[model samples]
Target: MPRILLIDDDEQLGPPLAAYFQRFELALTQALRPSEGLALLAQGGFDAAILDVMLPEMDGFELCRTLRKTSDIPVLMLTARGDVMDRVVGLELGADDYLPKPFEPRELVARVQTVLRRRRTAAPAELDPDEWRFEGGLSIAPTRRRVLREGTEVELTGTEFELLLLLAREPGRVFNRDDILNQLRGHEAELYTRAVDIVVSRLRKKLEPLDAIKTLRNAGYALALRRLP
Candidate 1:
């Protein structure tokens, strides 16, 4: 049974979610306060966590950061705001996913399952000698679904990691916005294209030592494999 810790101040939603997940055989623990959730997390293990952005004591973003510092336990943040900034901030703070408030319980369940599945599938493999290495400190560990810099781990949101992995896999291969978006999300490409650019910009900033990724005018982006001293 996958143990899930759900932290949300919405009293009415907690028990029902717990009940719903129980039917699926997931062991669920509900926490109404941030402190309570942190306590449970510190005490030990959980397969995943569903955190609400707005908490009485500490907000989900802070909690997420704190949790990431100690453990890589996948986290899904809940926010009623639905603002893109909130979602971006949550992701930057190392959240696996963010579902806006007033969301359907079933959708929540699906997101939880997706995150868990991703984590489970990400088992580290031995690095191959001929693997592509970006000039900057960035390197992708595909099997592990992790990115590292100078041998130090860099926390990446799920989407950002996918984008980085795809681009890094084929260095110098320019993937237009549509191609990249479709590949990253496993969905049809959007007509209007800024989504891919946005994700790439966010990813580039996180990948260091800087200048490893270059944007092509009227084309797309490519990894600059020329090493930097």
Candidate 2:
């Protein structure tokens, strides 16, 4: 069973939802406060998280931002309002997906599964060995889902890792926005193209001082590193 941490203060919603999740092979652990949720997450063993936007102290967005500093576990945000900006902000903060409040429990489960699937999926074998080494002190271990710069591990969100892997697979090949969206998510939603840019920007920040990705004006982005023998 996949362990899931649910950080929401909905007393009436948690118990029944926990029971329902068991039917789908998901183990749900509910935390009533952001601090409690952070504590539970620090202890490890969670596969993903379901965070609510409205909370007692720190809101879900704040918690998500703090959590990203230490953990890359997939996050699915629950927003009380159906605002696109809320979803966009959550994604910018490293959330994997979002669902509006008053959502069907079944739909929530489906969204959760989708987020988990994206995290669990492996990069194509055409990318080469489980481990990839590149010039400029860069290396990637796909099976372990890790990136290293000069022997030091670089922390990256799931989306960032996928975006890096996709570009690194074809060094010097500029992938346009729509191409990236299709390759990563299998659909060309314009809204998500912007999300891709945010992810790329975040990825570049994490890969600083080594300049591995290059941008093309009016085109797209490409990996600028050469494979190291």
Winning candidate number (TM-score): 2
Q: Give the clashing pairs for model 2.
A: none
- What is the overall TM-score of model 1 with all chains considered together? 0.76
lDDT of each: 0.73, 0.86
Flag regions of model 2 displaced more than 4 Å: 185-190
- Report the CA-based lDDT of candidate 1 relative to the real structure: 0.73
The TM-scores, one per candidate, come to 0.76, 0.91
| RMSD of candidates 1 onward, in order | 4.2, 2.0
Candidate with top lDDT is 2
Candidate 1 local Cα displacement, residue 173, angstroms: 1.9
- Which stretches of model 1 miss by more than 4 angstroms? 122-138, 183-199, 217-219, 226-229
Candidate 1 lDDT trough over 10 residues, lowest sum = 183-192
